[model samples]
Target chain A: MVFENKNSHWIDPYTHKFKESFKDINLLDKKKEYWRFASPSIWYDKFTLKKFQETRSSQSIKFDVTNYNFLRFNDGILDTETLRNFINKNKNVEICSFESIFLKKDHWSSLKFCQAQLNAEKSYERPLALFNGFNAKDGVFIKFKKGVKKDLHIIYEGNNKKNCCIRNLFDFEENSEIKVYEHFYGNSKYNVVSELFVADNSKFEHYKIINQDISETVIYHFFGNCKKNSKVKTVNFSFTDTPVRNEINLYLEGTNCDATVASMGFGKKESSICDNTVFISHQEESCKSRQIIKNALKSGAKAIFQGKIFVASKAQKTDGYQMSNGLILTDDCEFLVKPELEIYADDVVCSHGSISGTLNDDHLFYLRSRGIPLKEAQKKLIQAFFSEILDEVSDDNIVYYIQNQISEILTL
Target chain B: MFEIKDLHVNISEVEKKIINGINLKINPGEVHAIMGPNGSGKSTLSYTLSGKEGYEIEKGDIELDGESILDDEPDERAAKGIFLAFQYPIEIPGVGNLSFIRTALNSQRKFNGKDELNPAEFLKILREKADYLNVDMEMLKRPLNVGFSGGEKKRNEILQMALLEPRFCILDETDSGLDVDAMKQVSKGVNSLRSEDRSFLIITHYQRLLDYIKPDFVHIMAKGKIIKTGGPELALEVEDQGYTHLLN
Candidate 1:
């Protein structure tokens, strides 16, 4: 749904509706129904009907839930009597997290939907939309209870000899905040797409870091709604040979809403490129949105950044800013940055900017004459060029850790 | 301590000799100035002695203290106490001046099997030398000549020579672009570094610097060759009549 944000400083009007209506919103976000990052349902089924079926190749795994007619946890955690009560109390929720290690193909194929629970509502997200005509192939389902905040750390490792296609879905109840970290790394190469939904007053912060070796990945993401004062933040860092295209749309359906997306990409060698496209819509007045992407290109690599902001006619007083920059290290490298703004509201404050260029040549010459070799001289100049943004990263330990990783990455 | 016999430097694939040197000698406790007009190869002669590669040494045997150094690399020559205070001092950004000089000094020390000075010890000795030449303390904090002005850049060259304490420091036209005040300071720094065990090849086109760092002998260079040699009076003659008299 397009954001009807006006007067972006005001709290989201949708946040109030969810708290007031209080109906479990499984579709706060529309695109998420199409490109969910994961579907939790497959995980739930593993412990239920698929207990005998191993999700993976080896079955030396200790935890097998297939022997039980119903599977569940005790008191929201793994307690012995609580698990016994859950198994005896008519297993309602299917859980599949760490249990994936026991099964081949994942915790998914193990569980099958039993007709006995015909009255059961559908899970929150379904990632495998086209698998065997059973869209539940990859998905996550959460029966959100009011005021229950759950934290999840998810890592998507593309550990396949061949390419892989994955879809993910997630859900939240009213007044709940779900934070998910999606880290993507491949033993070789793969592509991943995800969809996300946010209910009223529910906050979702999805942090993604993708490293696809020297290949590429295509990413599609959408943020559904913020009923009053709900916020969402998305951060991405990509340094792979793969050219990745990320499309993010922030729909502010409520007042006093805020959304922020920041990303950094590194392009090197003859790799084609990394391009990011951001679409931010202010559907309500007083809704604020901000997006910034920085790309550093080296060798003959290329990078592109395209962002667009849309302010609805009804959405007045909206504030939005989009900035992008590309730093080229070699003459052969290239970059293109375009910031797009379509504001139907006249009173809104909106801004867009982009900058790209090669490293300063005179600076390199100066260092070399001082007896510093050419390559070492460049490393110093590059460090200086990126220092400004490096300081902005601000996490002292993380910054130092990343700097060491960057040195290792660029040693070639 | 220095000798160049039939030294010729050819650049590019072509056999055009930049330094068609016949011969010259620099003894200990002596400061010899090679004065020449533009393109007379004064800088080339000093560079060849310092051993910057790519300028192919076609035929020549340069000896320092009776040891042939023409077969050595720039670092080897530097180890043998040959320093070239460049006409254009290079700026090494990010590398602080104090550290750069110490690295160069310690590299020579490593080759010589001498003890290397720690940062604390090196700074102490460096500050004293800098104080003797009237160079500001701020200079040592900056990147090597990165943003230095013309005069400051030239003075930095001598600062390096003083800290390294080379035995044969060749000032490659170090006085070319300095102001009158800067010229005096450059000469003062050079004069402080001159000693009995060390020698100096003061390459210049004018005699203005000789007034401060008096040379033991003056040689007039023309077309890559030393066409004339005499005492300090020879500098006065060139200063009075220019290179026209020497050319004739």
Candidate 2:
């Protein structure tokens, strides 16, 4: 049975709308350009939406999330005790579950706040996004007041036979700044959709990590809107060999908006895949966007990167740049990259580049001639290849965490 | 001791002969110089000894310390105490110079069952040798051979040679692109490393380098064969009259 918010008044309307959008749509359409390298059949054939209940068991894998403001979704059910304790201790920003926030009818301002924020248009063109919009049972809603600063953490674990759909909406008012770190991993299949709204003069930084093992699959979709003088930066790391499909879209609706998207992917296991697709639209004047992606694929692994930038006719003085580099460790590994730009403005600058090659023979010989073994030499070069993107992360905590995680994957 | 016996090699792709029936021997503490014109197989012999790929060995063997090393990989040959200073050092981006040297040194030591040096100890040794070669400290921090001038590259090669301290060293055109003063500094660094248990094979096109490093035997090679062998005077003879006079 699909998840239903029976007791909550505010979210009941969206649930009905989600069910309406889910019917009469084909989820396995292969003709779509967005599904060129990835076939929806592979996902549909491998996973099912089975009803699962939380078992109250400890997490099999653990990461230190104590120091940061943390929340956990164990087997698709929110740990209410943990969430309540965290909320009581840190009341700087209003944080609560979507159910708790919408259950009461007398919270006039709260309902109005969420009604305005959560009612942002949901895209029906994508089947997975439509499914997630309707079936998502649990998620967190964060509301940041004007000129507020906050740090948030969200964790999603798909344990056992559970299939969970999560939806998150972040609303940042004018001059507010916020940073969020999201971690997704586990054995169950998960479909996640996030929508962010950055008001004028505000800033948002989103760092997401997908680190599932070979037995899991994650479908992630993100859509964001930036207003006048607002900025948005996204840094994603794909460390899982399991097939991960990532789609990101950002729209600059106001003047002087800026956006940056960067990602690092390492395909370490057999038949591992990381597919990333991004779209950025510039609708106003004096906006800028930058994209940098790098991938290192070992034997039997594949990586795909597709990115496009669109500049409207009135969006003059736009500056956009994109670069993608791939390193294939063996002949068996595969890398595919497609970077494009569409600009209608005459006074704009846009550039895109894609490069893929195996390790340089000269570089290998130089290392080996100095007495380094061949395997060690290749490892060192692979590490160097990834450092180009990893070094760009500005947050110390995230950088340290990512560095350790990357070392673990590469060394194995 | 290092010995080469009736060595014949050909370029792998074209199957053209480069080193034909070459024989030479060098005892410990002795320095031998091979002077040849271009296409005379001086660099080919050096590459063959260092086990570079694409050079097919058709006949004969090379022995170090009484055992043949012809079947070893390039890195294995390096671990067996063979060092080749290339005429043209390659530039490897994203690898620090000092870090590369340290890895090389420890790899060889590990093969020989010797304890590896920690970073502090490694830095101490590198600084001393680099200072002796007049190498700037900043150069060690840059990527290997990237943006290095000709003189700086040669000096860096010498610095590596000093740190490795191999049993057999081959300097293939080490003085090709250096000015007189830079040549002297390189020769001085090389001269300081001479000892009773180490051997040197210096290849050059002129006698100017031998004026400082003083080889015990000088061999003239032409058309893939060593034509003559004599004392230091043979180098002077080639420098004065050129290889055409020696050919006749």
Model 2, residue A1: C-alpha shift (Å): 8.1
* Overall lDDT per candidate, in order of appearance: 0.61, 0.80
List model 2 lDDT by residue over B1-248, tens digit each. Answer: 99999999999989899999999999999999999999999999998998888899999889998899988888888888888887888887767787789989999999889999999999999889888789998998998898999888889888988998888999999998999998999899889989998899999999999999999999999888899999999999998899998888
**How do the residues A1-412 of candidate 1 rate in per-residue lDDT, one tens digit apiece?**
0113223311223223323333333323434532232222322232232221221222111212233222222211122343344335433333332222123343331232211011111212222121211121232333334455544434444333333333343444567665655445443223333444455677767656554342323343443445557778777766565456565656676776788877777776664456666777787888888887777787777776767788888778898988887778778877776677888888899998887776555445434323334465566655544444454443354345445545655665
lDDT per residue for candidate 1 within B152-227, as digits (tens), equals 8987788778877788878888888789999988888888777898999898888888999999999999988889
Number of the top DockQ candidate: 2
Name the lDDT value of residue B110 in candidate 1: 72
Residues A1-412, candidate 2: write the lDDT tens digits.
3344355565556666666866765656667666767775545443453321121122224456888778888767678877887778775566667556556575423433323223333222555766676677777777788898777778877656577677777878899988888887676677777777789999898888876342566777778878999989888888877677777888888999999988888887665778888888888999999988888888788888889888989999999989998888778887787787988999999999989998887678767776787877787677667766666666777776777776666556
lDDT of 2 at B218: 99
Candidate 1 docks with a DockQ of 0.10
Candidate 1 wrong stretches, greater than 4 Å: A1-412, B13-15
Fnat for the candidates in order = 0.02, 0.53
